[model samples]
Target chain A: MEIAKSLQQTPSSYIREILAAASDKNVISLAGGLPDEKTFPIDLMKPTLETLSEMPEVFQYGATAGYTPLLNFLTDYFQLPDTHIAMACTGSQQGLDLIARAYVNPGDKVVMEAPSYLGAMQVFGLVQADIVTVPQTEFGPDIEALRTVFYEQSPKMFYAVPDFHNPTGVCWSLETRKQVAALCEQYNVALIEDAPYRELRFSGEAIPLVSDFCPQHSIVLRSFSKIASPGLRVGIVSGKRSYLEPLIKIKQGADLHSSVPMQALLLGLLKHDNFDYHIDTIRTLYKSRYETLYSELQDKLPEGCEIKPVDGGMFVWVTLPSCDTFKLAKELLKDGVAVVPSPVFYPQPEAAKAALRLNFTNATPTELAEAVSRLASGLAKAI
Target chain B: MEIAKSLQQTPSSYIREILAAASDKNVISLAGGLPDEKTFPIDLMKPTLETLSEMPEVFQYGATAGYTPLLNFLTDYFQLPDTHIAMACTGSQQGLDLIARAYVNPGDKVVMEAPSYLGAMQVFGLVQADIVTVPQTEFGPDIEALRTVFYEQSPKMFYAVPDFHNPTGVCWSLETRKQVAALCEQYNVALIEDAPYRELRFSGEAIPLVSDFCPQHSIVLRSFSKIASPGLRVGIVSGKRSYLEPLIKIKQGADLHSSVPMQALLLGLLKHDNFDYHIDTIRTLYKSRYETLYSELQDKLPEGCEIKPVDGGMFVWVTLPSCDTFKLAKELLKDGVAVVPSPVFYPQPEAAKAALRLNFTNATPTELAEAVSRLASGLAKAI
Candidate 1:
């Protein structure tokens, strides 16, 4: 049977293919946006995992939205307004898929930074949305270009990762946050704020979410994978009840509900006394790795290669002289360093500039140094 | 913001509303298709739960298809052909949703029996599929009518639950299964075999799956929810690689994958030496409860109300003399026995026959007898 027209339009994921290639023992992979396996707070979660057998109710079917105890806790944990609510998903990726299915129509325009999260692009692409992009500046998406697109295209939504953005690790400045929120409210575009790396900050103090400025006009997606465990496959989506109810309706057909045991386990970990400290440990570990990679690159990168220091989050963006970054990445992979090329992150690959996203969280300091030596050698040969 | 046009056309699930109301302590609910909580094999899963912390790799991100070990285990467990492969989903429900998203385009014809699974209807509805229905008879679907529909409608697929079918506990006769498979092959309509209740049988000898006759032209959804636990939210979908590749693409955006820890736990339970004994225990327990409900209804249902004997499955359908079933269900709810009305199951509600679906699982034999007493008194007053 032929596949759906909508699905036919979505190119199969390139990251999945590259990740598979990078998994060979011969390569050191910084290609995936994965939290380190060692960072998972299993000791903090042990009490809940053991307690699950005693709580038989969680093993039964649960409410379509989420487990009540988790939902109630998140409402307070996030300090949600009276009109707002929280729903759990298998992961924040599913939350984005739900938002796309619930709100987007074929040909509906969706705005995103040019170099955006690959997973978000895939979700919106599956719905056949007309994805529009604005160039990214170090602060975030180019604000002027964003305003012009919103003013002219009247897009349905703007999807963004404001706190330590993926691919570039460019957190939106506070002024830009308020401005983007205001623009969304003015344009009647829903702001989808994905903060999977929000808690991974190592150097800078935290800032307010863009959604904080316009709560009614935005939805926030939170991930615990960085702090807890990705294998639990649980994430939270919060917004006003009106915005979330349709997601719940779609979710009923999606999975009935996410795993109740996972949700309950999440709630238990969030309530644990050591949970806050666990986040700090992940931050310090990632920070040390990030600094090691940064200093190594600063010492070794060739002429015309520029690298930006990230305050928090998994990756650092390296800008190279215009060249075939894909070719560069292929050579680098054979050189035994795995980094994602810039084009894969762009909705229109041809429109992307020459750059690469290198992750720091998954590799050890010594491996980070070795990978940079391979990266620098490959770049010198290409440029 | 307006919901997507497709979502707007889909009705909110009435089953969900009814199930919520049925949760009242005063109501003896026959509205939900829930397995008894006592059936969950927690003891069998305990050893695995304690071992999860040691296996740090399972806590990391997994392949989108599933955890490798679970997929390999299911491949042999299901005795799938060398050409076939298995993938995990949050539930069989998500697998169905993925199939619709991957295969059905807007306005594409999809076929089902008149009274079908509500979740299936919702998934198809979300895709804006043109759902065409054929009538169902005691043996399964009306074979002649199915052939006519297949020839005329040219539906992309026929979604079915051939064994101990939902709402009406009518297991398809072996002859009907063969006929349906032949017609599907002849007409080139893909057969989607959903077998959540296939293992719940208590008395009858096992029958070959409808898919077995048309493996190349079918996708099979097998649920562990009824046998292990629904809260795990893990199910298996198996078919040829070509048939399953599109679903994996859609599933990449759905949840990346289902909960890895849950999948691991399920594998452990399935491997346990006593797992088969646990299923036999559930079968025996449910069979006893089914006997009580069947006998009570057989003895006490008002005149003109016809109750069919079910070989197995969760529900028993009661055909009533022409009347308002929605109103009848409401009265039964007030009478302290909650049962689902028939119209909710129909794509074209007005065309449905007056009937009620009474569940035989979840409630005890004593409660089932009392529920029947209440149902009989209420029917007498109404009819």
Candidate 2:
């Protein structure tokens, strides 16, 4: 039977495919953007689950927006006005789906940064949005390129990972964020700020949300998948309540609500003083992992291959010298190393290629050093 | 900001809106179709959570198709032949949304039972499908009416809650299900069987699924929100591998996966020897609740009102004599009683005006009797 035309339009996510294909018993994967399992707050989670179990409401269907306490905590955490937060089931990916369903119409233009989060691109493609990829400089999305795309496409919305972006672990500069916000206001484009990695910053001070820059037109999304636990599938969206109203309605029709027990656990965690302490520990762990991976790549990778330090977040983006990342990745998988090619990050094939996203978060420091060494040796032979 | 015209076309769910409005502290809620909290299988669930917590994989990002063991259990439970099953987050509501997004293109013709599940109606409406409701009879959907709709609309699919139907509380006789399956096969239409309440049957042997009759063209959905735990948000969709393939793709883009921890807990419960014993206990309890509700309604309902016994499910479908149930519900709520107007059950307005769905499962026998008594007295005074 023919699948729906809309799904036919959505290319299966390459990261998912590559990850699945690389599931060999031998492969050490840096391909998937998975948070290191060790970073999960197991000690705290054990106690939190005990507390959640005591509250029977935690195991029942919750409010469509979120579990009441989680929403309240998020509102306070984001320091948004009261009642401006909503929780989502799964990752922030569900947030993307809800936003697209709530606001986007078929054939509407959607401006996204080139080499963006593959999942967001997949969601936009499913919505049948005409995708326009704005160029990206090392600092984040290129402000001038964003302006051109906004002017040319007059897009309904612009999607970005302003804080420690996916695939390329570069946060948008504070000035660039204001410029983009100003352009969005000028062009009447809605801004979808996905900040899943916002809390993972190791050294940088927090940048004020673009929602502060463009309050009416912005929605900022956050997820526990990064710092807390992805297994619980809890995410939050905060913004102007006006923009959130439609999203709530969409969420109501999607799932009655996110899991109440998960939300309760998250709420319990957020309420504790240790939440900040946990995030700090995670930041330090990720930073050490990043250093180990970066050093190993520097030592082992052949000349002409280049790597850059990630300001924050779990990934280290690498560009191999004149090599097909996908083919090299496949060959490396045979030799027990797996990495996601960079081309899959773009909305369309015509954009660019020749890089790979290596996640340092999921691997141990020793494993990271070994994987990078193995990948370099594999690439040398394959090239 | 104006929501997209597409979302505009989808009507807000009548059940959700009424339930939200019925949140007044004084109002007795017969409005929501929620199951009794007392039957939450807390004993079983405690063990499930303990087992799940011990499993390290429970706190990780799972495969999009869902936890493998749960899928295996569901495939066995559904008695499908080599079918693929995927888990949905929150509840079966997300499953419906996935199906809508995966298949129902704009203006696609859909055939649904009149007075259908309001949640399904709302999702289909959002997909912009041309919805045509087939009249529901006491035995099942009106077969002749369905044939007529099929002839007229050439619908892409038919949606039904055959066993212990929603709002109406009527089960399609086995013969009727067989006939509907034949017709769907003849017309080349897919059948979406929503069986959240199937296992909740108070009496009678379980009817074989619509998929048993037409596996190739059927999708059978099940939910733990009803039997296991709503707050944990676990649901499954099982069908031929062919269709399930696309649905999995849709779900992947939608939520990535259901909560791994929740799935692990559910799988543990299902594997435990006490699982069936727990179901038996719930069934016995709900049976008593149903009897109490039926007897109370008979004793207290206004003269011309009728209440019928439902073989299974959480609801008692009541038809009031010549009174508008919506207005009567409001009057009853003022008297500290609440009921959902039956009109919301229908895909369109007219079918629901004179009826209301009273949930017998969610409340204790004493509470059910008292609510019914209040409703009877309020009905006498209102009309």
Candidate 3:
């Protein structure tokens, strides 16, 4: 059968193959971007679940925009500007997909960081966007390079993770965030600020959102997947009404609306007085895990290998001196450790073949220590 | 800001405007495809809710393919062939959207019933497919026209709701179903069999699925939205592994996966011995409601109006000889009744301007009677 040209262009088998290998019972999987399930607010959710069980409306269809209470609560919680509108999504992933569908025509140019979120890359690619990458310089997308891509390609959209970016765990510098906003505005490009990890700060002060800098041109994507519960699949996309109106319509055709019970559960949690306390608990747990993974990698990785310090979020990215991370990832499966090779994150795989991403949040500290030792053993063989 | 050409092509304001009017407190809505909230299996779900409350895995990230247990259960329940694979979707709407993304390339010809599910049309439009619609006869799409479209346009895909099709309440004759399957195979076109309402049959013998006739080239979409709980947002798409493999990859970028807790709830219900009994109860209730609507419309509608006898599903489609349903829908809103104008269902609105769809399942018999009276009054004004 003939498949869509867009589907044909996606990186279909590589990630699935790695994920399949990671699923082996003997392997310690540090590859998946999953939050630690132990930190999920089971106790806190009991009341909400009980209340929802009695409410049949929780099991009925919701407005395509979202459950109204959740929409209102998120709007207030985020302190969205007067010009903005918020719509709930099945997940932030759906939010990204909707944005791509609403704004990206086939072959439209979409700019991104050198190693961006593979999920977003897949969505853009499925829409048949011409994905152009700007290098990341420890902080975020290289702003100067972003300017050049904007002028050269006149891309329709620029997607960035402003805080605790996936795979790399690098937050944008405040100045870079401002420059990105300005560049998008100057080039008349839409800025997609994906902030799934924005609330996951373990160190450094909070940075102003890219949407704050370019409220009119930026659409900020947020999710409960990291701090609340990934399995519930609740998230939101907030932006100027003009952009959001199209997304809302596209979302109607996407899934009609998000799961109403999940939306109600989230609404109940958000409305609770102790919601912030629950988030604080999650932050403390992830922070400790991050520290454990950082120290273990520092002690175990080969000399000349580089590890970037993470301020927050689940992953720790490492750059090997001379290794093929994809090949190493496969070899490490035999050594009983699994990490995501960095090529999956890049629009062009050959551009970054030596880095790998380790997810520290899902594994225990003891497992992290053991996993790092196994990774080191595999790296030794590869180098 | 510039939007995608596809989004621009969609019917953005028309449906929303009607929905906004329907939402007024004074309006009695026969417009929405909502199942009655009172019929939701809250009592039956108590055990499942209790079980899920204790399972932390319910709140953790699920496999991108789906929760494994649900996937296995659905595959078995559907009695899919060994060559097939099943993947969970947020809902069947997402299933449709994914099929379009995986198969319908830009300007690729897609054939559908003239008055089909507007949701499917929107998804196909968002992908910029050339939508060539076949006219719907009472028994389904006109087989002769479908064959002509197949031979002439050589469409990439053919989307059909084989049983109790939306907005039309038409089930395909057994021969029609077989012919649709054979034609799709002969033309080398993928067939999307959306069967959300297949199980809601209150009359007539069960018709074998289109996939039953042509399993290799057909993908069948099933949803719990009609039979179980719409709010939970769980559905499955099953087809040959060759076709499903691409959809599974596209689903990875769609929303990662459906909500895990929702999947578990559905799994629990499907496993219970009383599951079929619960569906029987829904069928009985909807059948009575459908009868109520049919009778009330017969008593109230003007001379020269036509109504199809629904065998199952929530809708009763009406055709008026001298009235425009869109204008009548607006005028009826003033009399406190709301109905979905059928033009939205047609690819070309001018072709079906005199018909409308009324949802019988959500409203009570008394409300259905009252809505018909109000509709009659509005029709009087239009005539």
Clashes of each: 1, 8, 0
Q: Candidate 1 chain A: worst 10 consecutive residues by lDDT?
A: A11-20
Which RMSD values do the candidates have, in order?
0.8, 2.1, 1.9
Per-model i-RMS in Å?
0.6, 1.5, 1.1
In angstroms, the error of model 3 at A1 is 2.0
lDDT of 2 at A155: 89
TM-score of chain A of each: 0.99, 0.95, 0.97
Candidate 3 C-alpha lDDT tens digits along B1-383: 68788888887647768777888988999998888888888777778877777999989888887999888988889998899989889899999988888888779998899888888988898888898998888878888998998998888888888789898899899988888888888888888899999899999898799889989888999989888899999989899899888888888888988899989988988888888899999999999989988998889888777898978988888887755777778888889999888889988888874888899998888988889889888886787
**Clash pairs for candidate 2:** A59-B231, B36-B362, B115-B345, B115-B346, B201-B312, B342-B352, B342-B355, B343-B352
DockQ for model 1 equals 0.91
Identify the candidate with maximal TM-score: 1
lDDT of 2 by residue, A315-354 (tens): 8888777667778777888888889887888877645667
Interface RMSD (one decimal) of model 3: 1.1
The lDDT of each candidate is 0.93, 0.80, 0.87
TM-score of each: 0.99, 0.96, 0.96
User: Candidate 3 chain A: worst 10 consecutive residues by lDDT?
Assistant: A10-19
Ranking by lDDT: 1, 3, 2
- Per residue, candidate 3 scores C-alpha lDDT tens digits across A356-377 of 8999888988999999999998
**Candidate 1 vs candidate 3, TM-score winner:** 1
> What lDDT tens digits, residue by residue, belong to model 1 across residues B286-344?
99999999999999999999988888879899999999998989888999999999999
